[model samples]
Target: MSKLSKLSLITLFFWIVKIVATTLGETAGDLLSMTLNVGCAVSSTILIGVFLANLVTRLLSKSCN
Candidate 1:
């Protein structure tokens, strides 16, 4: 009903989505690198990309605040 309440619900939904998505990504990454033999380099690169994206977002958010 209120603005803060709406924002809280949105935040909770995003947190749940993120948890599921992260779990799915972990499973998919293992399947690709181990089951499909995609190699460690490819899998590591994918992980590094995720890390860098998070780092950049954190930096940007901190600067905005």
Candidate 2:
């Protein structure tokens, strides 16, 4: 119930979400590469751009904390 405990719980949840997101992203990128007949380097570059765009959008949104 303490602030420190609450913050730790939130931090832990964020880390869990991050891991899941990265795993999903990696899987999707590989699937996309195979479907598009692209190489790993190209696929990674495209995925990175997509991820960054989403991150920027999310950070800039008014609802973001």
lDDT tens digits, residue span 1-65, model 1: 99999999999999999999899888878987999898888987877898799988988884765
Q: How many collisions between residues are there in candidate 1? A: 0
Local error of candidate 1 at residue 48 (angstroms): 11
Clash number for every model? 0, 0
Give lDDT per model, in order.
0.88, 0.90
* TM-score (all chains, Cα) for each model: 0.57, 0.64
Cα RMSD (Å) between model 1 and the true structure?
A: 4.7
- Write model 2 residue lDDT over 1-65, tens digit each, in one string: 99999999999999999999989987888787888879888898888899899999998899956
Given candidate 2, what's the lDDT at residue 63?
A: 95
Query: Global CA lDDT of candidate 2, please?
Result: 0.90
Give all candidate RMSDs, comma-separated: 4.7, 2.5
